[model samples]
Target: MPVIVVEVMPKPELLDPQGKAVAGALHRLGISDISGVRIGKRFEVTVDEVTDAVLAEVTKLADDMFSNSVIEDVVSISVHPAPASA
Candidate 1:
């Protein structure tokens, strides 16, 4: 099987409240070395095969289903082989 990884993040112009909260917490915990933080989303989709059509579909899904177009952007989409069992 193949796995597709999708990354989504809020638009640069928008304010990310969750990320701000995390950054505030980190600063409170004495993590001042890190100036800023922006949290995003990662989605791993398992599929039977990897093909052009599949990739296109995944891209479409990433833009339409996985993220909100008004506020979020689909940052990246990558393909990887599934890990072998131990």
Candidate 2:
């Protein structure tokens, strides 16, 4: 099996409430230098293989099911080869 990791994040122009809250909390804790934060999602999936067709399907799924099409974007999909022991 190949391990696939999909990362989704809010568009840079969009406001992230969770990220803002975290930044605010950090500021109150005397972390002023850290001015911003952006919250995101990561999905890890294991598949039998890594191929062009699989990548395309994964992109579609990411757009339709895993991420908010309007405000979020899929950053990347990392594929790791299966372990020999498995």
Candidate 3:
């Protein structure tokens, strides 16, 4: 099977409270090298095949269903082949 991966992230101009809290925790733990953090979403959908139509539909789903249009943007969509059996 093929897997379609969709990645979404909050718009750069917006604030991410979850990510901010994580950064604060990191700072408290003495991990000072990192300056910021932004949380995002990743969706993996197993599919029978990959085609133009399928890609188009997935893109629509990403925009309309998987993410909030007002605050998030669909950053990437990629297809990966299934892993080989051991």
Candidate No. with top lDDT: 3
lDDT of 3 at 67: 94
Instruction: Name the runs in model 1 displaced over 4 angstroms.
Output: 84-86
lDDT of 1: 0.93
TM-score between candidate 2 and the true structure: 0.87
lDDT, candidate 2, 2-83, per-residue tens: 8888999999998999999999999999987898999999998877898998888887898899998799999987888898
The candidate, 2 or 3, that scores higher on TM-score is: 3
Q: Candidates' TM-scores?
A: 0.92, 0.87, 0.93
Q: Candidate 2, which segments miss by more than 4 Å at Cα?
A: none
What lDDT does the true structure give each of the candidates?
0.93, 0.90, 0.94
Worst 10 residues of 2 by lDDT: 54-63
RMSD of candidates 1 onward, in order: 1.4, 1.4, 1.3
Per-prediction count of colliding residue pairs?
0, 0, 0
For model 1 the local lDDT of residue 21 reads 95
Return the clash pairs for model 2, or none. Answer: none
lDDT of 2: 0.90
Ranking by lDDT: 3, 1, 2
Output candidate 3 Cα RMSD. 1.3
Residues 3-76, candidate 1: write the lDDT tens digits.
Answer: 99999999989999999999999999999899888999999998888999999999999998999999999999
**Model 2 error, position 72 (Å):** 0.7
